[model samples]
Target: MRKKYVIIKVFKMDERGVKLYQPDAQIKKGWLSLWRQMFSELIGSRELIWRLFVRDFLAKYKQAVFGVAWALIMPLVMVGVFVFLNRAGVINIGTTDIPYPAFALLGLSIWQVFATGLTACSNSIVAGGSMVVKINFAKESLVIASLAQALFDFLVRIGLLVVVFVILRVVPAWTTLLVPFALIPLLLFTLGLGLILSLLTALMRDIPHIVTLLTTFLLFLTPVLYPVPQGKLFAILNRYNPLSTLIIEIRNLVIVGRITEPLRFMIISLFCLFLFLVCWRIFHLVEPRMAERV
Candidate 1:
């Protein structure tokens, strides 16, 4: 009877009897493991991404008077300003092989993709705060949707570019067909920086303003209007500035049927790819905390 009365069960618990098997509040994870989980989650959320893109695409033009023409306005304005200045002798941009209008338009079109895409993605997380808080979805979807919108705008501008090409009677080389491939580095670099900027903007509202200011200044730093410079200082700058190489290469492919710096383009493309993966991982890891901040 005494031996039978001594039955006891042991349960795993903290000192206060809280279950030790409960899910961790935060887990330490290796970078590789985190990337695998992030990618898996993103793959599963592909439908959500497409839906979000459609929602954003429709919403963008739903009430706009000009519709997609708004995409044309910025590049047109920039081109107009510089063309006026050049014609008025306020500036002397060296002669371009193509018509000055077409040259500037081509460069602006490429630069706009990077500039607008970065701006859109950087603001996406904060802009979607209501949905982010209320819905269960991958936040990466917002960034991707914004990028898709930028791409849509880019495609629309391409139509205008064709008109410019036709008007100027500028017959691009066969390599012109390959010009689209040059967007690879621009997309990777923009997406990489955009992810990081989105998180920073979410935490600190001032980031968007800073980005706006910097973007305006960056145009001059990049060789969008003026030709790539010849001085040793500028030579070094152009060499290091990835946009310079990318834009120059695209122009060369279309106008000259050659790539200016093949090795540099390849190197920058790889660097951008690496940057995107790492920034995306950081974004994924920090995403759970975004709702609270925003």
Candidate 2:
């Protein structure tokens, strides 16, 4: 018997070799399944949504020196500053019979709620990037969580407003009931814008900076520190600025104890609903790409 030796050649594979050899059928199916699963998972995970909301609420003041008292303190400080400025002829409140401090407080209370809601919700997805990438819950829940925290802050600030109102001896009338109705459109409007901004900011890192700048400009445009004028420019600003109608309506019903313009409220409400639908659709469209981008 003759001994024979056989040599076999083995091919070495690079990192890309495995990927090239594998079929993408499972990957394509997975992505399709994930897209279909999003809505069902969102509906099924209400508990996680609530938990995230509560966590966000607590996180707002967790390590702060003043804790939640900062909420009450902030609006009070704003009212004080505006009152001094108005007295000094820096910012005029026009001929309104209400005291300057009270007027300022009322405007700040409503404006701060909307502003904070918009700010927090806009950064929500970016802030939750870690969870978004790692966790399997509904992404929309992040926006809801952020809004809930903002609402909590709003309610706390309202309590401070009640204290100030009591001290000022300004009795709220039946029109006070309309305050919540007025707030509905404002909330919807803020949440819509927040959703739009949140998704955009996640895609474009520069958006958050632009948003901050725009928010500062918007504050001056809004009638938070002064009454809306009746001039041509003011009229145009009021009609177009969503916050203008919302703030004016809130001040009229809550602080002024009257409801002189119901039609404006209806128009604002309709606009907010339209914005909500548009933002919701946009959010759904961009959400799939969020994890990939973030």
Candidate 3:
């Protein structure tokens, strides 16, 4: 016993190193511990998030001849087209005394942001499948990157909007300060819906097409091209459509220089938050499986 001795050796493995040890069990254990790991991974990848945002920004304009200038011009052309249509009486933007172009453009701007964000995020995981499968990073980063791209586009459109406001001599009111506040719920609403749709699309593959159709229908349901009519049904739809309320609130603040009805704000904000929390829970639950599916 005094002369005999045993030596045990341990080795660590790297990406290229031969595997020295492996866990054989398939069923994941320690639910709380797994969640903590996921959360920590997300927090640690903040720099990666910034890089993703920059990549999305450049990717949008890459190889495009006009580059970011296209962003400035596209909205003007859209507004010009709307003006022509409204002046020609092709589409009647409802009863406000504001110029049809201004009214339509304001609503369009908000709708476009939400729509673009939804569309981009819904397809984000499918489009970034390689990263989802091979990379050890937050899956939510796909949706966040899509949103960052949409936000950049929205900001560019806002600059064009300011130019239009000046050209039309439209004076923004002090209430315009609330515009950013109004945007909070809208972004939350969009993010919630986007995350849900994106996850569904990743599974169904047909959901993206369905989402496109639904968005088209929602545009009409919303008061974007026209005002919400004053009737029981229209009023009900308007109140229920988060985008409609968000757009209406933004327009009221920026164009009419008034805060939206407090009750409406409360309702919309609460609804948005509720939807966001629900979608967030769903997202976290499904995210761990995304790499396998993608």
RMSD to truth, every model: 8.5, 11.4, 8.3
Task: For model 2, state the Cα shift of residue 232 in Å.
Answer: 2.3
| Model 1 TM | 0.88
lDDT of each: 0.82, 0.75, 0.75
Candidate 1, position 151, lDDT = 87
Top model number, lDDT: 1
lDDT of residue 246 for candidate 1: 82
lDDT for each residue of candidate 2 in 180-224, tens digit (9 for 90 to 100): 777888888888889888888788888778778877788788988
Window of ten residues with lowest summed lDDT in model 1: 2-11
lDDT of 1 by residue, 1-294 (tens): 432211111123346956332222224334354556578778998998889889988898989999889999989998999999999999988889899999999888888888899999999998986888888678888998888889889899989999999998999899988877778878888988998899889899999999899788888888887777677988888877888888888888988998977898889889889999888877865666666677
Instruction: Report clashes for each candidate as comma-separated counts.
Output: 0, 0, 0
Candidate 1 vs 2: which has more TM-score: 1
